[model samples]
Target chain A: MKTIGKDRFGKIIDKSYFPLLVVFALVTLIPVYILVKISISEPVDVLTQHPTFLIHNFTLEHWEKVLTSGRLWPAFTKSFVVATLTAIFAIFIATPASYVISRLPKKVKYIVILTLFFTRMFPNVGIALPISVKFIRWNLMDTYTGLVLAHLIEQLPFITWILVGTFEVIPVDLEKSAMIDGASRIRSLISIVIPIATPGIAVASLFVWLNSWNEFTYALYLSLSENTLPLQVYYYVNRGGFFQTATYATILTIPVALITYALQRYLKSDYLGGAIK
Target chain B: MKKFFQKYHLEILLILPLTLYIMYFTLLPVLTTINLGFINADTNVFSLENYEYLFGRDDFRKAFSNTVIISILGLIMQLTVGLILALILKKTFKGKGFFRALILTPMGVPTIVSGVALLYIFDTQGYLNELIYRVTEGLKYIGIIASSYKFIPIDWASGGIRTLFMIVFADMWKVTPIVTLLLLAGLESISLQVYEASQIDGASKWQTFKNITLPLLKPSITMTVIIRAVDLFRIFELPMILAGKNTPVIATFAFEEYRLYNNPNISGAAATILLVIIMIFVSLYLKYIDKGEGLA
Candidate 1:
């Protein structure tokens, strides 16, 4: 019986999980491959055929067209600027607020959490009408600052709630230890709590960044002049002519796909506490 | 007073900006909605004329029905499919990790992209029809789906309410993985010992699932449903893109009133109604959550 138990444990450890994992791994790679192939393959080839496992020929014509067409750079800049600014804003706004929530009395904490959940649940469209009207009145429409503010409607609660989870995971003992050492609350938060919660911070920043970057609904309606990369890609997909538009779209997806892939690790993990487990 | 000043100063500082932002953005918007619901745009005086106007309109009633039908259908599709996929993927299987990542791909694609992609696949000359045609032709000899040869090529994009189904399907394709992931998280917390004990008691598969799994999963199921319902309720881009401005989800309808008609008040009225509904649902969901924790 002991030998059987030991053997079972050994089998659990030594069984070739990698071979089992390969099929699923291929499934993930298939879409990435299709997108890349579509981006590089000849327009004729793209139009005449469906996506296959392998490509017959490659062309850099699409990349050339995308670069020379001149919308790519501005769109890229818009997306980057929006994402970076939104991340910074969300993190800065959320950190202190979440910290306060963490320190509040239990009843207050529950109320605040509930409030956050409810407000976050408020569809962007609900406030979107009134908010956009206000933006237009204030001449904030079609601006980066305007888009950033609009994003906050969604980003604020997400960042705060996520950070709250991170803050909660850290025991009070750590903060008390810092207080005993004569460190100020702010000092402890900055020096000890923040460092320890770096992964959580990364997770929060990642969510904010991806959300702002990939967001289409507000960006579509709000930004009239400096269209974000997603807007440009979408415009091409819907409005631009066959080959040129497809090529532009294919070019557009590369950065987003990369960013998404990079952040897949955090996404895979249960970073937010509200997730079922 | 000095001690109070010292102790609460940080709290005041921390909360003030957030409060101000929320007040100006969230609270004010909701209030604006309520205020708008009370007054007519032309009169600029306080009245229930806007509400009466909304309540009286035939299209408004249709829109409400459509929205509810779509939301409920979308929720049911998402939950049922999501739960099944979650269960299927929970057990470790060959290539499970990679398939898991593949399943999550839809989430990474933006909503607008999803709208366009589904449009591409399901349009008349699209891949779906082509596949169906080929399959039907091949299957006719096998006596499967007897009207296989007579199958009409359905143009999904132009199919009014049917397009809503496509929109729901597209959304499900994107969000079901999220639901599955959430339920999978719930599943993770349920120890294998429970299942083992159920098995030892000679419980059948269905019985074990009903008895052991469903009860334990109620909280997570509730969370997923409530969150996803709220998410679907405020849906704008998917239906908007697929069905155009004609598709009247609450959010899109609000957008039209504010943007196209230049009638913020009407938009506000609609939004106010939506806001109250969502808040009520959210409060109930939270109450349940609290109760589950014995906190209420």
Candidate 2:
């Protein structure tokens, strides 16, 4: 380690990097801190000509208002349900397809992977309009099925891409051995391959869920009557006062923060970096 | 036929559902959007009226330019900031993991939430103005300037180039972490022996990074550019939430046209234009990825 450090740039970097890192860290954190501060601060503190860096008057009135206002829970439940279903369906759909793709010949696999990349890059609003129009025709508007299906358009390719990488890393010999033991291919996949690929599957599902939860465009189109948490937060930001918007935004962020913290260890760059290699 | 069925039946069955779903849901909608873009909304006949109408509008033209300009500007900022941060974290240092995790917190925050948080930070009476006001006030007390000078807050949300800068800054804050992570992965893949070799050849730090690190990090940079370009081109929520309807990007323009103006054809036209731009990036990305060793 010492030799590695001494190889090129040692002393200048060692002395200077710490302060730079601190500045970067503060730049990332201060906005989040202000969000929480405003959520708890009195209106007088937030809407003033000279807002304090720290909370000047801490109060729970905004949170209390948001909670009892009967708006948060519906959107909360709708978002949670939609996100959970999107994750489940995305995993179910993507895992099998990815497993198959992973086993394909090199040329075929490359083409399939490219197709997935293409689909993944399609602008959400472009597709969202057509999907919304179709959903309305099918009488699926403002329904869970509609939003979940819409969310899956993006999540499917993304999750499949991640899971294909996951499935690739698992040795094919493990499945072949199970097949020799009289296990059917499907049974082997269920009992052997999936258990081994649990971590990757977990990562894929985590991302799908997070994407669905944070999704705005599809929800904006399909979810007309009942709002998702993100849509609700957007509404508040547009119409509500600073305190209320802060409270809603803070509420929306808590679950995301907790999930990311718990799963941060699983966030290998391999999931994204695998594409170039 | 029986043997082929027996050999590949499970694979076929496993892959069928997703293929079908994507065909109906994903492919169909994209085709529908393109088709709608080319059709007359009222007469239901094939026409270029929608595109013609969109092209004639000042707001649509502005949205088009804004999307292109902002996406490029934001990607540059994200890449530069991301690379700097990635380099800082590439070394072994005290509290490195803590700082890495800390920086990623913004990425985990929902995009809408980030927009709202940025609004609070950049608003007229927001934290940024307050900080500036205090700094200038202290300078005034030291007789560096006239005491009559008042600190007036700039309306960052108001539509202009300044608002565009706010959008880019907010996007950089929220997105640079992912870029950092991707570049860090690229950095990790570089062998330390390369640096050691360069040092023995008497290369300076800047030279080593310029020649060695930069060249080696190309694939990752390419990957980052593709992802950031695609995502930034469709930047919807931040600009909408920050600048309102006055400063429309292509995505917001489409949304406003559909929802506010009740013109799906025009909206589809704008969206199709965005799709065309994004597809250019996608193809470039695919070509780059194709040049690599095939995925396992």
Question: Could you tell me every candidate's TM-score relative to the true structure?
Answer: 0.86, 0.95
- The fnat scores of all predictions, in order, read 0.32, 0.74
Report the number of backbone clashes for model 2: 0
Question: Per-residue CA lDDT of candidate 1, range A1-277, in tens?
Answer: 4443445433553354444444434433443445456567775555643423356777887778788878788888888898899899888888888888877887888888878776777767666766776888889888889889988877887788778778887988998899999999889888988899888888788778878887877786686677887777666665634444445545555556676667776664244324422
TM-score of the first chain in candidate 1 relative to the native first chain: 0.80
Among all windows of 10 consecutive residues in model 1 chain B, the one with the lowest summed lDDT is: B287-296
Residue ranges of candidate 1 with Cα displaced over 4 Å: A1-63, A237-253, A268-277, B1-3, B55-59, B140-151, B280-296
True-vs-predicted CA distance for residue B90, candidate 2, Å: 0.6
Residues B1-296 of candidate 2 have per-residue lDDT tens digits of 99998989989999999999889888888888899899998999999999889889999999988888899899889999999999998888778888989988886798888899999899998888888899889989999979999998888878778889899999999887888998998899999999899878777677788899998888788788888898899999898789898789999998888888888888898989999999876566657654542222
Clash pairs (backbone) in predicted model 1? A24-B98, A24-B99, A25-B98
In candidate 1, clashing pairs total 3
CAPRI verdict (incorrect, acceptable, medium, high) for model 1 = acceptable
Per-residue C-alpha lDDT of model 2 across residues A196-235, encoded as one tens digit per residue: 9998898789878988999898999887778888888888
Question: Candidate 2, which segments miss by more than 4 Å at Cα?
Answer: A1-14, A272-274, B1-6, B281-296
Question: What lDDT is reached at residue A130 by model 2?
Answer: 88
Error of 2 at B17 (Å): 0.6
